[model samples]
Target: MSIKQRDANKNLEQTKSHLQSNHAIHHQAKKNLVQQPVTRFALFLLGTAATILGIYAIARHFSWWQLPYTSIAVIPTEAAQASLPPNINTNFVTAVVDRVGPAVVRIDAAKTVTNRLPDAFNDPFFRDFFGSQVPQPGRRTIRGAGSGFIISPNGRILTNAHVVDGADTVKVRLKDGRSFEGKVLGADPVTDVAVVQIQAQQLPTVKFGNSQQLQPGQWAIAIGNPLGLDNTVTTGIVSATGRSSSDVGIPDKRVNFIQTDAAINPGNSGGPLLNQQGEVIGMNTAIIGGAQGLGFAIPIHTAQRIADQLVARGRVEHAFLGIQMLTLTPEVKQQIASDPNSWLNVDEDRGVLVVRVVPDSPAAKAGLRVGDVIHKLNGQSVTEADAIRQAVENSAIGKDIRLELRRQGRTLNLAVRPGAFPTAQVE
Candidate 1:
């Protein structure tokens, strides 16, 4: 063989060996690249499982293992329902009515009312022409209905004076379907409180609450026979307290009334206004005409006070100073000063101004004349006329009351003895 052929043969063999080595290395690299992704996926799955197990252990430690898997529902028991708010249910009212219903009564009063003939019928020419044919006066019956509450076990009931006023017959009906003839023991028109006696035993009586502690926004429930409907119940909140009689348009009454939004019709006058505990707090009395949610009630304290007097003495004598007055304000003073025929001079403001002093009354006897501005009563400052009236009402009859007045820029102190309110005036 030639030397060139031998060299070529050797170079070919070396190239073939080099190619085989490169192919082996490329196959191993391809196999490793395919296995790398599988190993990474298995490691990721193991890490996720560990995280889930750790979370389960923490939940079991906190006793919240069932929180994510279980649903919870709340169920109220009887005690839970009872512990709920009062406004959520009418159970309070129902309880009150059930407790107090038996003591409430229906009062039906009847009176004989005579109708008189006109004056023209009595003329001489007409009488002569008619000659016993003239229309004669007719007699009729006036019937009224109201409500009352039993105060004593022996059938002593408290009601409004107007309920039995001029009544010839009074019939009382109870909840147990029993009726009785009621006799008026006494009636005080000033306080509008009356006591009726019925011969009975073992009667259900009412419990009275303190009206002086009453506040606005308290519950008020009224049970009455309004418009001839028996056992009518109404509910509302107390709108205000200590409302003057004048503020309620009942100047003749001498009561500090409890104002409520409860429904009060004609026949609800004497019914009991109860509190949440079923205690009598007031007496349903009056309501403003054509106004919604405006009703007034006499305080239970005042009603009981007057009722006691009526039962004990067959009458109530209210203390009277007999003076017509008004609260003095800057506008009133200015009006009086500007008027030519006011016939009075008011120099001070923010006091009760005596517009007129009744002749021969306790005020007049004590030299309390018109134009005097009453500044104080019994060492207490007085700004409203109702305050003076209340002071006089609180005073005993024939007892001296101290008065401080500003008359023509001079302050004077006087003592006046109150007199009994006249029955004729009340009638």
Candidate 2:
């Protein structure tokens, strides 16, 4: 090959490589321009038209952005929340806070005690080390802080029974800086609602709202003295209702808890959980920590009833079913299916099984026998042991109800009368 030909070929190759690189660079520059802010903005306006139209035009309802926006977060307004069903309400949050805030009080509990060695303490080293003169530390009283709400204008307070259960002294602090030494009224173990008294007049009271009216997604407000910060208010929505926990055992229980997402913490116990209308719907009792959006409240329906009894007679009388029951798990359901006609003590799918019938109690008198699977009572269907217990408690004592029982291959209906529950004795 000639030297001149080789040199010409090299020059051609160099020009071709330079042109390819320039074309690649120009193509990338055009692509980058397509992703610029101007281009993206235009696309957003065009693509978001459907979303915006649905929000603003197709539906006239207000959303988070459409509702009044302000930097002055003057507490959440329930009127801003969407009402359930036909959606006809406004300013629930305001009504709730306004009606209940004054009634919400700061509860300060202190224990006064002299420590004594346990009666069971018998250490051999203690006898030798001090020559029978071992000095044990003196007992000291401890103080705990919590919150509660007044149920009456005349100084009756509603709080968790545990809040002042064993306290030597309890101080109730009002919003107006009035502190009253509280006297323990009566506490119920079934619902954990307690009534306490203060030696004062003309106190602020919170109006009780019907908890059964609370719906899922309704706004929930929590007011309490959390971490010693009095009058702390937090907001969320009612996530659910009718939550039951075995962690706190109450057989023949009528507790129906309202669950909320409001930030309830350790000191939130005994505080009023108000609905958007600012009405006391439940009492903040517990928080499942480490997990977000899990908080529980004692429903006001039971609380109010218990409070009335506590205030009037100092105790609540209950009815006895006299039957031990258990929740039907999946495994139990299969066992139940195997004998559709046989009376079952264990059912994985349905009603609580009547385990042991108390000799002379309501269940025994009502003909509720062992192995009888209770499916419904008084026309209401029973799904589990809790439902059975709740239904029975909610009903009046001495009332006769039709019970549906599945006995050997035949569905039997029996009528049984309930016995009056024993009155609670509080010390």
Candidate 3:
């Protein structure tokens, strides 16, 4: 009976153990499936977050999110950096100051005449607008200040036409602090370049650079005698180009000006507009309407040419074609006939149209007539009025050049000598 009971108990225990093992295996398999999915999902989220942070870091490093290209400068040139040498290639503006600072001068002009202002402003009618202004028409001493530059070593200064415009007595100052009486050599109101020669010789003369090559945002320096302050140097950059003064009474004019945001005051006129290379690229002449940092200068190419002529001959002998020209108009085409003369003497439209012919000018001498269309100067085609001016300016005085012209529907060749530019004071 003991043996039978032992066998049965052992079989029961074996069956229970087998069932427990199967259940344990099933539970382990279920736990593994759930844990594997959760682990994979957590790893994927961590990888995505790391990738986003990396991309953000790269974008911040590259500055791709900034303005593409609008021209705006950050800082103005330092004021106290006049001693450094200004080289065109150098980034430092101080180098430019050193180049032209020696040549820039101070002009102390005095018109010793009785004040010509009238006292009628003291009347109540004038007081309202002019604020109790008194016009002293009587004689009173009138003293004023201006700026100038020494173009030659022998103290020949270049100043504004207005500075010594009506000055009775003029005094020039050097950087070293010597003052000398100056006599006006010649002043051209059209170009605003004047030549004044002093007794001094071997003076520090500023070098000239080509303004035609000046680029906007390049460093610019204005060295002048501002407010009687000699050798005053200020800094800025080229703001604009090819500006016209048609609004300021000087209409029918073409000026390739260097615009700068430099701080230019009234007395800064006639100062040298220098490039970062410290070369005189232009002459500071006018500013826009009491505006701050809006200054304009005459291209040095124009100034130097005019100054050279004024100093040499006391006048600019602009060659005269003695003809009136108009931009190519539709009316001009109507005038041209289909059958132009044998010498290509047919009316060709486009470009400047000749309106009138002057009586004894070089053009008249060269047998040019009204209705003659000039297509090219030398060999290049003429497109604008500025092109003609620039071409004629580049020519030396009395240089014979060939012109290709269209007249009455005929193209012809005309040879003429360029004369000195004439001062055509706008009527």
Candidate 4:
């Protein structure tokens, strides 16, 4: 009986054991199915989040897409900015030209030149056959053109002395095409300034400016009839000031020219060299031949003073010291040193060397000797022959001039009263 019971119990236990194992396996399979779906959904969500983050980082780094919170102002390109005009007034030059262009006049001068026969042809035999008057010389009219400006309301005009010096008739043509016959009030060759009068009244006159106030690099405007071109305006800057007329080879003139770069041609003489304010600071007088940007003008102050004298008196008298001198240069000093018979012995190389002294003249009366080196005139150091010459001309006729000289390595001072320059004695 125990064996049978034991065997039944064992079979039942075995069946129970098999059913429990089956149930355990089925529960684990169901749990695995549920967790597999959850894991797949989480992996998909992580991949999507990672892709979105990568796209946002790329956009931020490259600025491919702008944020809504930012604002920027646009800037113009260089080309667009360069198209703007300068801050200064662009019409300044035009305004100055418009103001002074009308007062400038063109002068046409005609002179009768009589060509004479040779002295041999004027022998007594030929003179008798040609009828006692000796054959009359052929006469021809020489014509020249220049420029000038009105200085007074009564038709008084200012021009260069050379313009109408020997002219039989002088004609002035205005910018408005009205022509008038000009009468020579007076002409001073030493100053190269002259005044001509027309019949017209209430004419326009140029305003004079202070020539002493001119500075280098200041704007200069020149208005004149150059090469027969009427009312041509040229613009440039002041190159220099206080240039002597002899510096430009005008030996007879006693003018300190105002050097400018403004174009001045042959016909531009006596025209105005205006400042930026449209005031006449100078009178255009000469130009360096074959050189561009080399023009000179007489200072307005000098021209005005000379004009007043020529208008009041028939002639202007210049002061004379009566000495011929040369600037002491290294070459001149060497030449003087090499010459054994030269009365001049120059130890210093920077003064005016007096070469000749006119007998009984102011310089000779003052005891100025040949070979004496003039170091200073008054208080100014004399460096050039022209400087001393200009100083003499500018001094008062009766004024005493103190001359500092170096003779034989000794400094000497002498005083001289300048006399009137003889017109016939001028070389």
Give TM per candidate.
Answer: 0.78, 0.66, 0.59, 0.74
Estimate, for each residue in 48-122, the C-alpha lDDT of model 3 and write its tens digit.
999999989988877764748774533224532445345433334555555556777777777756654456656
How many residue pairs clash in all the candidates, one count each? 0, 18, 32, 0
**Number of clashing residue pairs, candidate 1:** 0
| Local accuracy of candidate 2 as per-residue lDDT tens digits, 30-121 | 88987899988988898899788777864565556776756644444544343233444424555556556778999999887787776534
Which of candidates 1 and 3 reaches a greater lDDT?
A: 1
Q: What is the alpha-carbon lDDT of model 1 when measured against the actual structure?
A: 0.89
In candidate 4, position 18 carries an lDDT of 100
Please give, for residues 1-427, the per-residue lDDT of candidate 4 as tens digits. Answer: 6999999999999999999999999999878875897877987899999999999988877774564555353333343234335553335566666666778899999999999888977687886787766656798999999999998888999998998989999999998999999999999888889999999988888889999988999889999888989888999989999897778778667888899999899999989999877789998999888999999999999999999998889789889888888889899999988998886667878899888888888989999998899888897887898888877877899899999999988999999998998876652
Predicted structure 2: lDDT: 0.77
Q: Using lDDT as the measure, which candidate wins?
A: 1
Supply the TM-score for candidate 3.
0.59
Candidates 1 and 3, the one with greater TM-score: 1
Q: For candidate 2, which ten residues in a row score worst on lDDT?
A: 81-90
Question: lDDT values of the candidates?
Answer: 0.89, 0.77, 0.72, 0.86
Candidate 2 stretches with Cα past 4 Å from truth are 1-100, 112-142, 245-253, 329-331, 335-349, 356-360, 364-369, 407-427
Report how far residue 79 has shifted in candidate 2, in Å: 10
Ranking by lDDT: 1, 4, 2, 3
Worst 10 residues of 3 by lDDT: 337-346
